[model samples]
Target chain A: MDLATVTARLLKLATKVSDEVGSIISNPELDARMDRVPANLGPYGVDPFGFDPEYLKKCMGMVSWIYHNYFRCQVFGVANVPEGRCLLVGNHSGQLPFDAAMVSTAVFLEREPPRFVRSMIERFVPDTPFISTFMARCGQILGTPENCRRVLSNGDAILVFPEGVGGLNKTWRDRYRLQEFGQGFMRLAIETASPIVPVAVIGAEEQAPTFINAKFIGKLFGVPAFPITPTNPLLPVVGLLPYPTRYRIYFGKPLQFTGDANDEDEVILKKVDEVKATMQAMIDDGLAAREHVFW
Target chain B: MRILITGIAGRLGRRVANRLRRNHEVIGIDRRPCPALPTDIVHHRVDIRRRPAEDVFRHAKIDAVIHLGIIHNFRIPAEQLHARNVMGTETLLKYVSKYNVKKLVLLSSGDVYGASAENSQFIDEDVPLMASQRFPEIRALVAVDRMVQSFFWRHHDIETVILRPTFIVGPNVRNAPSKYFRLRVIPTLMGFDPMVQLLHEDDLLRMLDASLKPGLRGVFNLAGTAPVPLSRILKILGKPTIPVPAPIARALLERAWKYRLTSFPAPELDHIRYNTVLDTSRAKEVLGIEPERSLYEILEPFRAEDQADYTD
Candidate 1:
């Protein structure tokens, strides 16, 4: 057979596998929840940013299972996420971005008329293999002001981790402390007049329990940081898997602000601090209420 | 109105000529001769940088000029190609200004807005032309686009419309999109499926026709259907693609390009790796130019035949 025939057959088989796996992971309730989120798909069943709801649904089964069984997530105040355009500004933790995933999953599951939260990923993410296209298909876009503005104007919910890599690569010593936030999201919120929903993800900071951020090593590998955790380095690949800590996701009431988007940095930072202070308060509250990390 | 179209021998140029010839007097200039030219349309065989190109404008009272003669042949030496494109455009702009040409339409590609991870979903005309930063081969195109933009502001009386359309794909067009899709088994970056926009040649012809209207002048980003993933586009065409890792693919393509085995430049791989979608709101609002063809209609020509031999 020609290469085309062989490749086509392989693709067909791969799709079949994903379809079977998807059926196993997907339940009627989860399907209904996904249906609530309106999809602005084109003729070929893809959104303008290449988000394919069908593809997302098929892969949701595994992610859903992880959300329910693995992490055993407890989501609160999901209704606080407004029906229209809003930004879910949250803390960036869990070196691998499992926090973003769990938070998005919680909203997708708990909210009535489920809102598919599009998270702005790191710039280097689009350069990575498999993860790049996979993330786009799953409704995540590159974090640019323009992208955020576009999605916000389209009345879609967006999740932003303003701390970016700062909070993500934090050692266990710095856990629960809020990192300095970037002011870009605040400007976009002001420009688009979208509400900011401060999200506090409690358990993610303890998942990896990083001992040190090997910056020099990371520079050699051309990554942001080389996170050395308890299980990693010794166990190699398998050790990199995060501990199954119980996830507590808190979605705060939507905060609204108005002003010139192009205002001075100090002016923008003041507004950004409001959102940051709210998140830190929420995080502290969630930590006090939680019984244990590994429930 | 008498319209002078450069690069008329090219597929898009010929299509534009045929569409415009019905109402306006069509005059074409190209180094290559158009074999089956209609009897009514006048054809001139000369390079835009040459004296004969100026002589045509010096004699005929040309009302409008469609500048499409910019060369995109990477096989040619960079210096020679750059001179031909930039110098040719400079010469044409001078002639148009001197001869009192009232209208000018230059066909630019959306690729001037380089594909990058930092790019917005729909890049508007205001975004800087940064393609030359990564892909040095496209420096001439970016230079020409900037030159035309300055010309647009400098001459108020002359209506200058710069139409930066996305990848043009049609039956007759032999652009990078068309040529890549024509491959039996296309090689794609393993982890990258950036959203891409396609413009049907016919829709582009329509936009060209629409731009020739009396008063419409400004840079308009012409986009076809909504942006879709590269994988979905290939799936629609039923073409099997081999997913190669980005670095390896880049290395192999660079080697092949050096040996003249592949037409695609290694730098151009960024197009497939990151988003470069254009926002066409200005085109929709100002020029009232909307793409007429559907996604399926645009890909129909590239779709594989159902009964094609697979065993061979």
Candidate 2:
């Protein structure tokens, strides 16, 4: 081989080695030391490292890369995110679940110690090997009521897309529209007496325009989409990459539901609708105020 | 009679305006200016949520309002949908009742049928309005219907006609089944034989003509008699059909719902998946008018346009 070709092959080998090392270092067991909390902070009742701050910082860095490089996100109204145990509800966009990453990064950057968001994980994530381990250690759990209540009671900020899977799965044609939200979050908040903060994230939809979803293949593949999306699913090795687009996180004022905790279902549903309306309005206003649809 | 048509620029609104123009002295009210209508059809530019109802209503000797302006998508934000569809309707109803308008015609969609499996094949005016578990727009419309029903029953001498339409197919639908059909790619079965109900915009106007007839009041399902498959409609357009696996299709739909791809599936995909069909016999019986165009006929105008130019 020529001198240049040999040099290029050596560089490729070096990159592969470094990637493997990085992957090994990111393993949950290797980073178990990050979970250690300092003894001096016991009086404050805050276990700073209880969540593995180093791993969190690394995750935050990854999130920053995704937001800045991939989504080019510009977040605002993060100051409206309450200090503790508040339910953060925002408008979800795109088929892939990147809004959670953006919101998590925003909270991490805004808050001093960076409050961890209790997120809902897909069934597939936990079933996977490496990703499952990292996600579990990083603090994302199933969005069932039991977990939501547990997370809220323990004074952790919970982020939920009340519209659930429907909101994120919206097509390119229905961009910026808030789908019907379920009453679970409202019920959880009322049951736990936690405040609900409405957040509006504008400009995530333009990054990836999903016009049509072919469902039959998605079921066979055990994922939402098997062949479509910006990243080809058949090429699973590189399927996780998201298309870059501008993102803005707009946080609205917190809405506290002080009605009877044991209120009837009708009342709770009404309150849930009200909260959804508030969040929808914030999203509309945010989009309207923007000079361009995409940043 | 002095009438206010909110979406005067729309297909149904223009038809309603055209039908009511000479006899009723109609005053058209729209968010955008319409150059097609005659000058006598009074036009006003105001957002129902942001503009005062009195200011819009006080312009003439307003007798009734045809509320058609709304952001019609299930994936739309609850607040915006509420503000435009629910609050705007509420504001219009409140102002019209306050002004002692004789009647109001509120345009509602058959999507109020939340879950298809729970609903009977034929939904009538008396069918119970159930809240949708998936779509927020339907919930908002349900709220609008409740508000209108309560206000008309208790508050004033005002008469209200709630028209629930099923899959309105025409030239001016701006989006949806129209956009999908224009692209020659509507999700359908292998045989293209899923039953569908549609009403031509012109026939819908004729129904509006009947709605304005003396002493007409009550809810009616305005749709066509026969059901047509989406495949047949695409065949009429002569567009190539691509078969997608159902599971992958649903996942893609869910993804589209997340990203706001197509407006039709976001809030109503579950219902569509279950083949939600509406009974429009009440419209035929009460309105005494049959829609002129069939599903195939509705696709004619766009069929004439080059397929390449129909990009959404």
Candidate 3:
């Protein structure tokens, strides 16, 4: 074949591949879900926190695919999320943050008048390379009280894993167990007068069943936790990938508590415990209803 | 109205002086000589800390004082910057109070809030000045802002208005943001696209004029039309950008600044990495300010073709 014919064939192949990818990414149902959600965009087509819905739409293709095909996320009680600002306090697990992604995607794709959930990421996440910019553009901000207050006041859904690294980095023995919750989320909910939607994400714990957690190693590497899973030590790169455990996301009823946000820690812990109890119950219920982890 | 403007030799001061000269008796005090100063307005070439600076107020019946004479050049020596900015502000406040000036407008900056991952998207004036914590070179400006704020409370008689405007950019303005934007190939921190705020020089002058109103006395944050990402601002100006990693960029900038090869200090890189957008609702409601210039108009001068001289 001549060079021109080869070039034309290559161009045709590129166009064909891109067209297929476009068709796969674009869904009328997803577009309809996006249309139902209210976005407060500035004149430059981004929110105050630098969230661009267009950017999110472009990036959600892979995540959306995983939601429908890979993990097959089953979401329930999304209507429990109130109209305005509310905190989505959920169990953090799966070693990686795929649980957070599944929860946010469920709310975005499955809820009525689909909601946009801004996940409060770890502080160190913003210091990472391309991930920081990608997260910001997709509507995740550094987990700070001020950012939380601002996001809540703007009437946007914010997903916060109050258990933090404790729940996420927990070993296999602690699977399906609730970690000690932080009182900050409760304080914020009371202060903003926003309801709290306790979330329970099942099957995430078994995805990367950690056998041992090495703290000193994590400290030396400047990471949150060093978990030793079976595949992690053997496969290295591929080990980072989580198992295809079917996700069941349960968003509980909106819990409203009225009191001083500046109250004592003891008082705040009681409120935090209430949220923890709700999540643990939901998680237990979800685990009982599930037949198999991979199904 | 007999108005006294300190730092009248600077770009903002000159524009303000030229505008107020039409209707009021304008008096300018600056150590630097302004060759293009209008012939009608009175100019006193004297440092504010010196004895002669007091004579400008002593000689004339100064009704109001517009204090914009802040030295924000990070290259200057620390003690000199502190002495000149803080002491100069001290001397000026003494004269304003002693002369019984009815209105006082101090030109502060939104940079006093500092760019941090911890900062809220729209920082209010109520937040503490934490810029010094990261960039110690900007401590003098933060100190001056705090000093004037205390003075505002003590002097109930004076209509003290502190205007904390974001990076002011214009054709003539040689401030950090303007010079940074003027770069042929602006270098940005890799993976970081912070939302930035910019106020046009003309809009700032309008706010300064409105701040001269009799009873509008409080610290107000002056922001531009809207806050956009730093990359978007560069895109609007049609400038090519090179995104370098944070560590390499900081190291290069430090060496370049030390050798006097670059004007942007290494610490100033934080401005491009994190958000410090200001809340302008207070200024809009109080001063009734509607920012006249859009983002494109604000960045028009720095366009690739419009700028002929690319000298640092």
Candidate 4:
């Protein structure tokens, strides 16, 4: 055989060696999971997205650190969350969704029985690298009305940011301004009879104050936006560190709307507007109540 | 009841025959002679397509016919497989209907569902058969499945119970996934982590036993274990997962498959990237049979074989 063919064969063999060693060291507790958990599944259950209790436990540990230490996140009115299926309508912000993470972390760690919030991510998320499977395994579904319906039907709480990309990619000037919410969540709540829990996340606005929305960068990299923060352009490495703002998450009372999913746009937008107004009012209240951006 | 089981020499077929032999009479038929069967159970060495299956049907009144003759090996040529699976099944189905057999059980694969991103979380029986779209070779099996279903609908008297089971692995069974898993290193498509389920040998045998019971008819997805991601399965087994980029991996697999050097073909790579998690609630509720072992418990039984190879 030629040298090239021989090199290819040798390279393949080397990859196997590295993978064996890499996973063993990287995931030191993998062997421990095998010993601790009953193999595969048990008589009573299984989460459809290949959700692993062990992996979720590991992730919760890190998210709790960020919630309590980094963000200093304080959740209020969490009792408003219904026992069964409900739509969590929150304002999406801070470029990175530290908002969703904090809300889910609150439910997971703080609540009794500990719930895992099924966050509906943007459509483009699954198209990214290692993130797709990671998100699925974490019980995050693609942000589609069909997927949302399915999750609610299963009686799981779902987090929906109706502003979609428009909310998360807003510049510093529009930080506190609520965008036009997507009408899908309102329709979902109506269709599945899932109560809507409007949430307002304060202090996330100052986290990564974005000044530039480079559409060119979004096109080049296939991202929602190529955002530029003060620290981001000035200090390349440390720029990613959002200012440790003291976050206050307020979960409002459940709002139930009765209507058909096949209702007119005007009909759906009215309900969507009501949810938006409630969230805006909460944001106003939280903003007034906050002592400082970082304490 | 006197029953006839095709491909009876195959691991699963033999197990099915052994189970049935305990209570009922069995006639095992295969193209290859099987020396391992019990003397009490009669064996016929004949290809269903070439020979008239009526010869066996005429010998004794066959109450139930279990067709397990579909060749699942990927190395076989497409034309030969079509002849063996499609034509052979057509001939057998005709004989079963003609011989006035009360029931016909056709063992099939879950791969018939076809793995894709578009599928819902847990696919029930109503989902379209999309497996043939990606891998045309699976068309023969799909055809058989459709034929069985049509026969079920067309004739009310002959009870046709079609089972589409997922990757079944145990000590004795051999298939694409098990063969790939047995190796020290397993290659997977990069950036894809499809959920997969496993059925135990006992679970499968039990399912076959359930089909024979009165009032069990219709299409059923026979699966017992909860679905697990491909990476976790490899990790649990202590086997290395070499995630090759999809394009390069596809080309390499096609070449490797052509040489008969690989256990899985290029098309099977699509499976590692996407998933088909069958909802087996019907199998549980209606059949009154639940898989005794969880997906992990079934996998646990195979650790000894995997560990022995790794140690060597």
Ranked candidates, highest DockQ first: 1, 3, 4, 2
lDDT of 2 at A152: 77
Model 3 per-residue lDDT tens digits across residues B1-312: 999999999878889999999889899999999778889888999999999888888889999999989999988899999999999999999999999999999999999998887776679889999999999999999999999999999999999999999999999888788999889989989988888888999998888998988787999999876878888888777778898999999999999999999988888888888877898888888999799998888888888885453321
- Candidate 1 lDDT tens digits, A62-181: 888888878999999998988989999999888889999898888888887778999998888887888888998999988888888999999999999888899999989999999989
Q: How does each model score on TM-score?
A: 0.93, 0.47, 0.93, 0.77
Error of 4 at B45 (Å): 4.6
User: How good is the docking of model 3, as DockQ?
Assistant: 0.54
Worst 10 residues of 4 chain B by lDDT: B303-312
Q: Candidate 4 residues B1-312, lDDT tens each?
A: 899999998888888999999999999889988986888999988889766566998879999989998998757888888889989899998898888999999998788888766666677776778888988878888888888888899989988899888888886777877776777677777777877888888999998899888767888898867777777677667766688887898898899988887777788877777766788888888888878876556666545453644321
Stretches of model 1 off by over 4 angstroms after superposition: A1-24, B307-312
lDDT of 3 by residue, A1-295 (tens): 9999999999999999897577557756566666567888898988878898878887677789889878998888888888899999999997889999999999888877789999988878766767878888898988889889988998989999998999999999999999988888999999999999999999899899999988788899898888899898688779979998898889899999999999999999988888888889999999999999999
Using alpha carbons, what is the TM-score of model 3? 0.93
Tell me how far the alpha carbon of residue B167 in candidate 3 is from the true structure, in angstroms, after superposition: 1.5
Could you tell me which 10 consecutive residues in candidate 3 chain A have the lowest summed lDDT? A27-36
Output the better candidate (1/3) by lDDT.
1
Residue-by-residue lDDT tens digits, candidate 4, A169-263? 89999988899788878888888999999999998889999988887977986766877888875787588678999889899999999978889
Scoring each candidate complex against the real one, what DockQ results? 0.62, 0.01, 0.54, 0.22
Q: Regarding DockQ, does 1 or 4 come out ahead?
A: 1
**Best candidate per lDDT, number?**
1
